[model samples]
Target: MNKALLMCLLILPGHAIALVIDSSKPIEISANMVVIDERKNISTYIGKASITQGSLILNAEIIQLFSNQQSVIKIIAKGTHKQLAHYQQNQPNQSRFIEARALNITYLIEQELVHLKGKAHLVQGFDSFSGGTLDYDIKNDKIITSMSKDGTQRVRFKIKL
Candidate 1:
Protein backbone atom coordinates (compact mmCIF):
# COMPACT_ATOMS: atom_id res chain seq x y z
CA MET A 1 0.00 0.00 0.00
CA ASN A 2 2.84 2.38 0.86
CA LYS A 3 5.61 3.45 -1.52
CA ALA A 4 8.34 1.82 0.56
CA LEU A 5 6.48 -1.49 0.52
CA LEU A 6 5.90 -1.23 -3.21
CA MET A 7 9.60 -0.69 -3.79
CA CYS A 8 10.46 -3.81 -1.85
CA LEU A 9 7.88 -5.78 -3.80
CA LEU A 10 9.66 -4.85 -7.01
CA ILE A 11 13.08 -6.26 -6.13
CA LEU A 12 11.38 -9.50 -7.07
CA PRO A 13 10.62 -8.84 -10.71
CA GLY A 14 9.13 -12.21 -11.53
CA HIS A 15 6.19 -11.64 -9.27
CA ALA A 16 6.11 -7.99 -10.17
CA ILE A 17 6.13 -8.46 -13.93
CA ALA A 18 5.80 -12.01 -15.22
CA LEU A 19 3.04 -13.13 -12.90
CA VAL A 20 1.58 -9.67 -12.43
CA ILE A 21 1.94 -8.03 -9.04
CA ASP A 22 -0.04 -9.40 -6.17
CA SER A 23 0.16 -6.22 -4.16
CA SER A 24 -1.54 -7.82 -1.21
CA LYS A 25 1.40 -10.11 -0.59
CA PRO A 26 3.93 -9.18 2.04
CA ILE A 27 7.31 -7.76 1.04
CA GLU A 28 10.37 -8.24 3.21
CA ILE A 29 13.85 -6.74 3.23
CA SER A 30 16.90 -7.62 5.32
CA ALA A 31 20.28 -5.97 5.57
CA ASN A 32 23.02 -4.93 7.95
CA MET A 33 21.28 -1.59 8.26
CA VAL A 34 18.27 0.22 6.86
CA VAL A 35 17.49 3.90 6.95
CA ILE A 36 14.33 5.64 5.92
CA ASP A 37 14.29 9.37 5.30
CA GLU A 38 10.72 10.38 5.80
CA ARG A 39 11.29 13.95 4.70
CA LYS A 40 12.84 12.85 1.42
CA ASN A 41 10.51 9.86 1.07
CA ILE A 42 13.49 7.61 0.51
CA SER A 43 14.64 4.34 2.00
CA THR A 44 18.19 3.01 1.84
CA TYR A 45 19.47 -0.42 2.70
CA ILE A 46 23.20 -1.03 2.95
CA GLY A 47 25.57 -3.94 3.49
CA LYS A 48 24.49 -7.19 1.91
CA ALA A 49 20.89 -6.14 1.37
CA SER A 50 18.42 -8.88 0.61
CA ILE A 51 14.81 -8.34 -0.46
CA THR A 52 12.30 -11.07 -0.96
CA GLN A 53 8.73 -11.25 -2.23
CA GLY A 54 7.13 -14.62 -2.65
CA SER A 55 9.67 -16.89 -4.38
CA LEU A 56 11.77 -14.04 -5.74
CA ILE A 57 14.96 -12.86 -4.06
CA LEU A 58 17.35 -9.99 -4.68
CA ASN A 59 20.76 -9.42 -3.14
CA ALA A 60 23.08 -6.48 -3.44
CA GLU A 61 25.50 -4.27 -1.53
CA ILE A 62 23.06 -1.39 -1.46
CA ILE A 63 19.41 -0.90 -2.30
CA GLN A 64 17.74 2.46 -2.49
CA LEU A 65 14.07 3.28 -2.88
CA PHE A 66 13.20 6.74 -4.07
CA SER A 67 9.72 8.13 -4.02
CA ASN A 68 7.77 11.31 -4.43
CA GLN A 69 4.83 12.47 -2.37
CA GLN A 70 2.54 10.47 -4.66
CA SER A 71 4.34 7.12 -4.90
CA VAL A 72 7.59 5.32 -5.57
CA ILE A 73 9.59 6.63 -8.46
CA LYS A 74 12.56 4.28 -8.77
CA ILE A 75 14.50 1.52 -7.08
CA ILE A 76 18.21 0.94 -7.46
CA ALA A 77 20.48 -1.86 -6.37
CA LYS A 78 24.20 -1.43 -6.51
CA GLY A 79 27.07 -3.85 -6.00
CA THR A 80 30.79 -3.36 -5.80
CA HIS A 81 32.56 -3.36 -9.15
CA LYS A 82 34.06 -6.72 -8.29
CA GLN A 83 30.82 -8.09 -6.99
CA LEU A 84 27.37 -8.31 -8.57
CA ALA A 85 23.81 -7.63 -7.55
CA HIS A 86 21.67 -10.70 -8.03
CA TYR A 87 17.96 -11.36 -8.60
CA GLN A 88 15.99 -14.55 -9.06
CA GLN A 89 12.28 -15.01 -9.67
CA ASN A 90 10.16 -18.10 -9.86
CA GLN A 91 7.20 -18.17 -12.24
CA PRO A 92 4.73 -20.80 -11.24
CA ASN A 93 2.45 -20.43 -14.24
CA GLN A 94 5.29 -20.62 -16.71
CA SER A 95 6.93 -23.34 -14.68
CA ARG A 96 10.27 -21.55 -14.98
CA PHE A 97 12.30 -18.90 -13.27
CA ILE A 98 14.64 -16.10 -14.28
CA GLU A 99 17.94 -15.14 -12.70
CA ALA A 100 19.97 -12.00 -13.28
CA ARG A 101 23.21 -10.49 -11.99
CA ALA A 102 24.93 -7.20 -12.61
CA LEU A 103 27.04 -4.55 -10.97
CA ASN A 104 24.05 -2.22 -10.92
CA ILE A 105 20.35 -2.75 -11.45
CA THR A 106 17.60 -0.18 -11.70
CA TYR A 107 13.86 -0.41 -11.89
CA LEU A 108 11.84 2.56 -13.07
CA ILE A 109 8.52 2.47 -11.35
CA GLU A 110 6.66 4.70 -13.76
CA GLN A 111 7.68 2.86 -16.91
CA GLU A 112 8.00 -0.60 -15.46
CA LEU A 113 11.40 -0.89 -17.07
CA VAL A 114 14.48 -2.68 -15.79
CA HIS A 115 18.06 -1.84 -16.65
CA LEU A 116 21.16 -3.82 -15.78
CA LYS A 117 24.69 -2.60 -16.32
CA GLY A 118 28.30 -3.65 -15.94
CA LYS A 119 28.89 -7.29 -16.83
CA ALA A 120 25.24 -8.16 -16.73
CA HIS A 121 24.14 -11.78 -16.94
CA LEU A 122 20.59 -13.08 -17.26
CA VAL A 123 19.17 -16.57 -17.36
CA GLN A 124 15.63 -17.66 -18.15
CA GLY A 125 14.72 -21.32 -18.34
CA PHE A 126 17.38 -22.99 -20.51
CA ASP A 127 18.49 -19.78 -22.18
CA SER A 128 21.20 -17.55 -20.80
CA PHE A 129 22.50 -14.17 -21.89
CA SER A 130 25.58 -12.24 -20.87
CA GLY A 131 26.62 -8.76 -21.88
CA GLY A 132 27.75 -5.40 -20.61
CA THR A 133 24.17 -4.19 -20.31
CA LEU A 134 20.63 -5.47 -20.47
CA ASP A 135 17.35 -3.60 -20.66
CA TYR A 136 13.93 -5.05 -20.33
CA ASP A 137 10.81 -3.09 -21.21
CA ILE A 138 8.24 -4.97 -19.28
CA LYS A 139 5.35 -3.05 -20.78
CA ASN A 140 6.31 -4.21 -24.25
CA ASP A 141 7.86 -7.49 -23.14
CA LYS A 142 10.99 -6.60 -25.05
CA ILE A 143 14.64 -7.09 -24.19
CA ILE A 144 17.64 -5.23 -25.54
CA THR A 145 21.25 -6.09 -24.78
CA SER A 146 24.67 -4.80 -25.69
CA MET A 147 28.31 -5.26 -24.86
CA SER A 148 31.60 -3.42 -25.31
CA LYS A 149 32.63 -3.49 -28.96
CA ASP A 150 36.34 -3.71 -28.23
CA GLY A 151 36.35 -7.21 -29.76
CA THR A 152 37.50 -8.56 -26.43
CA GLN A 153 33.96 -8.18 -25.16
CA ARG A 154 30.91 -9.38 -27.04
CA VAL A 155 27.37 -10.35 -26.27
CA ARG A 156 26.94 -14.01 -25.50
CA PHE A 157 23.78 -16.07 -25.40
CA LYS A 158 23.25 -19.78 -24.96
CA ILE A 159 20.27 -22.07 -25.38
CA LYS A 160 20.65 -25.57 -24.05
CA LEU A 161 19.02 -28.60 -25.48
Candidate 2:
Protein backbone atom coordinates (compact mmCIF):
# COMPACT_ATOMS: atom_id res chain seq x y z
CA MET A 1 0.00 0.00 0.00
CA ASN A 2 1.04 3.60 -0.43
CA LYS A 3 3.06 5.15 2.39
CA ALA A 4 0.81 8.19 2.75
CA LEU A 5 -2.39 6.17 3.26
CA LEU A 6 -0.65 3.72 5.55
CA MET A 7 0.61 6.60 7.66
CA CYS A 8 -2.91 7.91 8.05
CA LEU A 9 -4.20 4.56 9.26
CA LEU A 10 -1.39 4.17 11.76
CA ILE A 11 -1.01 7.71 12.97
CA LEU A 12 -1.64 8.37 16.63
CA PRO A 13 -3.17 11.49 18.04
CA GLY A 14 -0.64 14.29 18.38
CA HIS A 15 -1.44 14.77 22.05
CA ALA A 16 -1.03 11.10 22.87
CA ILE A 17 2.37 9.98 24.05
CA ALA A 18 3.98 7.12 22.15
CA LEU A 19 5.94 4.38 23.83
CA VAL A 20 8.73 4.28 21.28
CA ILE A 21 12.03 6.01 21.87
CA ASP A 22 11.54 8.53 19.11
CA SER A 23 7.93 9.31 19.78
CA SER A 24 7.89 12.64 18.01
CA LYS A 25 9.21 11.30 14.70
CA PRO A 26 6.85 10.60 11.84
CA ILE A 27 6.36 6.94 10.80
CA GLU A 28 6.24 5.63 7.28
CA ILE A 29 5.22 2.12 6.22
CA SER A 30 4.83 0.20 3.00
CA ALA A 31 3.70 -3.27 1.98
CA ASN A 32 2.25 -5.22 -0.90
CA MET A 33 -1.09 -5.62 0.86
CA VAL A 34 -2.71 -4.44 4.04
CA VAL A 35 -5.73 -5.67 5.98
CA ILE A 36 -7.27 -3.67 8.75
CA ASP A 37 -9.78 -5.20 11.18
CA GLU A 38 -11.36 -2.42 13.12
CA ARG A 39 -13.34 -4.78 15.29
CA LYS A 40 -10.18 -6.40 16.55
CA ASN A 41 -8.12 -3.24 16.42
CA ILE A 42 -5.49 -4.95 14.33
CA SER A 43 -3.76 -4.12 11.08
CA THR A 44 -1.82 -6.75 9.17
CA TYR A 45 0.61 -6.07 6.40
CA ILE A 46 1.53 -8.84 4.00
CA GLY A 47 4.38 -9.41 1.56
CA LYS A 48 7.50 -7.33 2.11
CA ALA A 49 6.32 -5.13 4.95
CA SER A 50 8.56 -2.34 6.12
CA ILE A 51 8.10 0.35 8.76
CA THR A 52 10.44 3.25 9.36
CA GLN A 53 10.61 6.15 11.80
CA GLY A 54 13.66 8.32 11.84
CA SER A 55 16.65 5.99 12.23
CA LEU A 56 14.60 2.95 13.25
CA ILE A 57 13.60 0.48 10.56
CA LEU A 58 11.83 -2.87 10.63
CA ASN A 59 11.22 -5.29 7.83
CA ALA A 60 9.58 -8.67 7.58
CA GLU A 61 7.46 -10.93 5.37
CA ILE A 62 4.46 -9.94 7.46
CA ILE A 63 3.88 -7.28 10.06
CA GLN A 64 0.92 -6.96 12.40
CA LEU A 65 0.06 -4.02 14.58
CA PHE A 66 -2.37 -4.05 17.49
CA SER A 67 -3.60 -0.72 18.62
CA ASN A 68 -6.18 1.24 20.52
CA GLN A 69 -7.82 4.43 19.41
CA GLN A 70 -5.06 6.52 20.93
CA SER A 71 -1.85 4.60 20.30
CA VAL A 72 -0.30 1.33 19.21
CA ILE A 73 -0.22 -1.44 21.78
CA LYS A 74 2.01 -4.01 20.16
CA ILE A 75 3.70 -4.96 16.93
CA ILE A 76 4.55 -8.39 15.62
CA ALA A 77 6.75 -9.25 12.68
CA LYS A 78 7.29 -12.65 11.08
CA GLY A 79 9.64 -14.02 8.47
CA THR A 80 10.64 -17.41 7.14
CA HIS A 81 13.69 -19.24 8.40
CA LYS A 82 15.66 -18.44 5.28
CA GLN A 83 14.98 -14.71 5.63
CA LEU A 84 14.65 -13.73 9.25
CA ALA A 85 12.77 -10.56 10.16
CA HIS A 86 15.06 -7.60 10.80
CA TYR A 87 15.01 -4.63 13.15
CA GLN A 88 17.52 -1.81 13.42
CA GLN A 89 17.79 1.52 15.18
CA ASN A 90 20.42 4.13 15.79
CA GLN A 91 21.59 4.48 19.34
CA PRO A 92 21.38 7.86 21.01
CA ASN A 93 24.67 9.79 21.08
CA GLN A 94 26.41 7.03 19.11
CA SER A 95 27.36 6.71 15.48
CA ARG A 96 26.80 2.93 15.49
CA PHE A 97 23.44 1.19 15.26
CA ILE A 98 21.77 -1.80 16.86
CA GLU A 99 20.62 -4.52 14.48
CA ALA A 100 18.60 -7.63 15.21
CA ARG A 101 17.15 -10.59 13.33
CA ALA A 102 14.84 -13.46 14.16
CA LEU A 103 12.09 -15.58 12.68
CA ASN A 104 9.57 -13.83 14.90
CA ILE A 105 9.82 -10.45 16.61
CA THR A 106 7.33 -8.94 19.03
CA TYR A 107 7.44 -5.40 20.30
CA LEU A 108 5.44 -4.51 23.40
CA ILE A 109 5.13 -0.80 22.97
CA GLU A 110 3.91 0.22 26.37
CA GLN A 111 6.40 -1.98 28.17
CA GLU A 112 9.24 -0.80 26.00
CA LEU A 113 10.35 -4.37 25.40
CA VAL A 114 11.26 -6.30 22.28
CA HIS A 115 11.09 -10.08 22.21
CA LEU A 116 12.85 -12.12 19.56
CA LYS A 117 12.41 -15.84 19.04
CA GLY A 118 13.84 -18.49 16.73
CA LYS A 119 17.41 -17.96 15.55
CA ALA A 120 17.53 -14.65 17.39
CA HIS A 121 20.63 -12.54 16.94
CA LEU A 122 21.44 -8.96 17.88
CA VAL A 123 24.36 -6.62 17.42
CA GLN A 124 25.08 -3.22 18.97
CA GLY A 125 28.16 -1.49 17.67
CA PHE A 126 30.97 -4.10 17.89
CA ASP A 127 29.21 -6.37 20.44
CA SER A 128 27.11 -9.27 19.21
CA PHE A 129 24.71 -11.72 20.83
CA SER A 130 22.91 -14.80 19.59
CA GLY A 131 20.50 -17.21 21.21
CA GLY A 132 17.27 -19.15 20.82
CA THR A 133 15.39 -16.26 22.38
CA LEU A 134 16.27 -12.64 23.10
CA ASP A 135 14.44 -10.13 25.25
CA TYR A 136 15.50 -6.54 25.00
CA ASP A 137 14.43 -3.96 27.58
CA ILE A 138 14.68 -0.79 25.59
CA LYS A 139 14.01 1.50 28.52
CA ASN A 140 16.74 -0.10 30.60
CA ASP A 141 19.09 -0.68 27.67
CA LYS A 142 19.57 -4.32 28.65
CA ILE A 143 19.29 -7.68 26.90
CA ILE A 144 18.50 -11.13 28.28
CA THR A 145 18.78 -14.34 26.30
CA SER A 146 17.86 -17.96 26.89
CA MET A 147 18.83 -21.32 25.45
CA SER A 148 16.63 -23.23 23.04
CA LYS A 149 14.04 -25.52 24.59
CA ASP A 150 15.92 -28.58 23.30
CA GLY A 151 18.97 -27.25 25.18
CA THR A 152 21.05 -27.65 22.06
CA GLN A 153 21.56 -23.93 21.48
CA ARG A 154 23.13 -21.76 24.09
CA VAL A 155 23.30 -18.00 24.33
CA ARG A 156 26.51 -16.58 22.93
CA PHE A 157 28.04 -13.14 23.15
CA LYS A 158 31.04 -11.51 21.53
CA ILE A 159 32.44 -8.23 22.73
CA LYS A 160 35.07 -6.23 20.88
CA LEU A 161 37.18 -3.79 22.76
Candidate 3:
Protein backbone atom coordinates (compact mmCIF):
# COMPACT_ATOMS: atom_id res chain seq x y z
CA MET A 1 0.00 0.00 0.00
CA ASN A 2 1.06 3.57 -0.65
CA LYS A 3 1.16 6.13 2.11
CA ALA A 4 -2.08 5.61 3.94
CA LEU A 5 -4.66 8.18 5.09
CA LEU A 6 -4.89 7.99 8.87
CA MET A 7 -2.15 8.60 11.42
CA CYS A 8 -3.20 6.75 14.55
CA LEU A 9 -3.90 3.09 14.00
CA LEU A 10 -1.24 1.13 12.15
CA ILE A 11 -2.26 -2.24 10.69
CA LEU A 12 0.06 -5.10 9.72
CA PRO A 13 0.22 -8.45 7.93
CA GLY A 14 1.16 -12.16 7.97
CA HIS A 15 1.99 -14.97 10.37
CA ALA A 16 0.54 -16.15 13.61
CA ILE A 17 4.10 -15.66 14.77
CA ALA A 18 3.69 -12.04 15.78
CA LEU A 19 5.32 -9.26 13.86
CA VAL A 20 6.48 -6.41 16.04
CA ILE A 21 5.18 -2.89 15.50
CA ASP A 22 7.44 -0.02 16.40
CA SER A 23 4.74 2.13 17.90
CA SER A 24 7.09 5.03 18.41
CA LYS A 25 7.39 5.50 14.69
CA PRO A 26 5.07 7.94 12.96
CA ILE A 27 2.23 6.81 10.71
CA GLU A 28 1.47 8.10 7.23
CA ILE A 29 -1.68 7.79 5.18
CA SER A 30 -2.70 8.67 1.64
CA ALA A 31 -6.01 8.18 -0.09
CA ASN A 32 -8.27 9.56 -2.77
CA MET A 33 -10.44 11.21 -0.12
CA VAL A 34 -10.24 11.36 3.67
CA VAL A 35 -12.85 12.25 6.21
CA ILE A 36 -12.31 12.90 9.87
CA ASP A 37 -15.19 13.14 12.28
CA GLU A 38 -13.65 14.58 15.38
CA ARG A 39 -16.88 14.35 17.31
CA LYS A 40 -17.39 10.74 16.47
CA ASN A 41 -13.74 9.99 17.05
CA ILE A 42 -13.37 8.40 13.65
CA SER A 43 -11.30 8.95 10.54
CA THR A 44 -12.30 7.39 7.27
CA TYR A 45 -10.34 7.10 4.07
CA ILE A 46 -12.15 6.17 0.89
CA GLY A 47 -11.04 5.04 -2.55
CA LYS A 48 -7.59 3.56 -2.81
CA ALA A 49 -6.89 4.12 0.83
CA SER A 50 -3.40 3.11 1.79
CA ILE A 51 -1.64 3.02 5.15
CA THR A 52 2.05 2.86 5.94
CA GLN A 53 4.10 2.60 9.10
CA GLY A 54 7.78 1.90 8.95
CA SER A 55 7.95 -1.16 6.67
CA LEU A 56 4.30 -2.16 6.85
CA ILE A 57 1.76 -1.36 4.16
CA LEU A 58 -2.00 -1.88 3.95
CA ASN A 59 -4.38 -1.12 1.12
CA ALA A 60 -8.13 -1.15 0.81
CA GLU A 61 -11.08 0.56 -0.80
CA ILE A 62 -11.98 2.06 2.57
CA ILE A 63 -10.12 2.24 5.87
CA GLN A 64 -11.77 3.32 9.05
CA LEU A 65 -9.56 4.46 11.90
CA PHE A 66 -10.74 4.83 15.45
CA SER A 67 -8.85 6.59 18.18
CA ASN A 68 -9.11 7.80 21.73
CA GLN A 69 -7.46 10.80 23.36
CA GLN A 70 -4.12 9.17 24.13
CA SER A 71 -3.65 6.84 21.16
CA VAL A 72 -5.12 5.09 18.18
CA ILE A 73 -7.40 2.26 19.21
CA LYS A 74 -8.63 0.31 16.23
CA ILE A 75 -8.48 -0.04 12.48
CA ILE A 76 -11.07 -1.50 10.14
CA ALA A 77 -10.50 -1.92 6.43
CA LYS A 78 -12.71 -3.23 3.67
CA GLY A 79 -12.32 -4.24 0.05
CA THR A 80 -14.58 -2.94 -2.69
CA HIS A 81 -17.21 -5.09 -4.38
CA LYS A 82 -15.99 -8.51 -3.24
CA GLN A 83 -12.38 -7.68 -3.87
CA LEU A 84 -9.67 -8.24 -1.26
CA ALA A 85 -8.12 -5.79 1.15
CA HIS A 86 -4.39 -6.33 1.56
CA TYR A 87 -1.33 -5.83 3.71
CA GLN A 88 2.38 -6.47 3.26
CA GLN A 89 5.73 -5.97 4.95
CA ASN A 90 9.34 -6.70 4.09
CA GLN A 91 11.62 -5.33 6.75
CA PRO A 92 15.35 -5.97 6.69
CA ASN A 93 15.22 -8.51 9.50
CA GLN A 94 12.53 -10.46 7.74
CA SER A 95 13.57 -13.17 5.31
CA ARG A 96 10.80 -12.27 2.88
CA PHE A 97 7.64 -10.32 2.48
CA ILE A 98 4.70 -11.31 4.62
CA GLU A 99 1.27 -10.66 3.16
CA ALA A 100 -2.42 -10.97 3.95
CA ARG A 101 -5.68 -10.46 2.07
CA ALA A 102 -9.35 -10.49 2.98
CA LEU A 103 -12.61 -8.82 2.18
CA ASN A 104 -12.57 -7.28 5.64
CA ILE A 105 -9.62 -6.70 7.93
CA THR A 106 -9.67 -5.33 11.44
CA TYR A 107 -6.86 -4.63 13.82
CA LEU A 108 -7.22 -4.00 17.51
CA ILE A 109 -4.22 -1.88 18.29
CA GLU A 110 -3.89 -2.20 22.03
CA GLN A 111 -4.48 -5.92 22.04
CA GLU A 112 -2.19 -6.41 19.08
CA LEU A 113 -4.64 -8.74 17.42
CA VAL A 114 -5.83 -8.91 13.83
CA HIS A 115 -9.08 -10.38 12.58
CA LEU A 116 -9.37 -11.23 8.92
CA LYS A 117 -12.69 -12.26 7.51
CA GLY A 118 -14.46 -13.06 4.26
CA LYS A 119 -12.02 -15.12 2.22
CA ALA A 120 -9.10 -14.51 4.47
CA HIS A 121 -5.66 -15.51 3.30
CA LEU A 122 -2.31 -15.00 4.99
CA VAL A 123 1.20 -15.84 3.98
CA GLN A 124 4.41 -15.64 5.93
CA GLY A 125 7.38 -16.44 3.83
CA PHE A 126 6.36 -19.74 2.21
CA ASP A 127 3.80 -20.70 4.87
CA SER A 128 0.17 -19.85 4.27
CA PHE A 129 -3.38 -20.17 5.53
CA SER A 130 -6.80 -19.50 4.03
CA GLY A 131 -10.18 -19.57 5.67
CA GLY A 132 -13.41 -17.71 6.20
CA THR A 133 -12.13 -15.97 9.30
CA LEU A 134 -8.68 -15.75 10.81
CA ASP A 135 -7.71 -14.42 14.17
CA TYR A 136 -4.08 -13.63 14.76
CA ASP A 137 -3.00 -12.86 18.29
CA ILE A 138 0.30 -11.13 18.06
CA LYS A 139 1.23 -11.28 21.71
CA ASN A 140 0.77 -14.99 22.04
CA ASP A 141 1.74 -15.86 18.51
CA LYS A 142 -1.41 -17.85 17.91
CA ILE A 143 -3.78 -18.17 14.99
CA ILE A 144 -7.35 -19.41 15.01
CA THR A 145 -9.40 -19.99 11.90
CA SER A 146 -12.93 -21.14 11.35
CA MET A 147 -15.45 -21.88 8.63
CA SER A 148 -18.39 -19.62 7.82
CA LYS A 149 -21.60 -20.16 9.74
CA ASP A 150 -23.23 -21.82 6.76
CA GLY A 151 -20.40 -24.37 6.63
CA THR A 152 -19.99 -23.62 2.94
CA GLN A 153 -16.41 -22.44 3.61
CA ARG A 154 -13.21 -24.22 4.60
CA VAL A 155 -9.84 -23.48 6.14
CA ARG A 156 -6.55 -24.40 4.56
CA PHE A 157 -3.00 -24.28 5.86
CA LYS A 158 0.37 -24.82 4.23
CA ILE A 159 3.25 -24.64 6.67
CA LYS A 160 6.86 -25.01 5.66
CA LEU A 161 9.20 -27.22 7.63
Sliding window of 10 residues with minimal summed lDDT for model 1: 10-19
| Cand. 2 Cα-lDDT | 0.81
TM-score (all chains, Cα) for each model:
0.77, 0.87, 0.80
Per-residue CA lDDT of candidate 3, range 41-101, in tens? 7788899898777666789999987766555678889996566899776534447776789
Which pairs, if any, clash in model 1?
A: none
Model 2 misplaced regions, further than 4 Å:
1-21, 93-95
Q: Put down candidate 1 lDDT per residue, 41-102, tens digits, no spaces.
A: 77889999987766657789998877765556777899887779997766443347777889
Worst 10-residue lDDT window, candidate 2: 11-20
Q: What residue runs in model 3 are displaced by over 4 Å at the alpha carbon?
A: 1-21, 90-97
lDDT for position 54 in model 3: 63
Task: State the displacement of the C-alpha of residue 14, model 2, in Å, after optimal TM-score superposition.
Answer: 7.0
lDDT of 1: 0.73
Instruction: Please state every model's RMSD to the true fold in angstroms.
Output: 4.7, 2.9, 5.6
Model 2, C-alpha of 159: deviation from truth (Å): 0.8
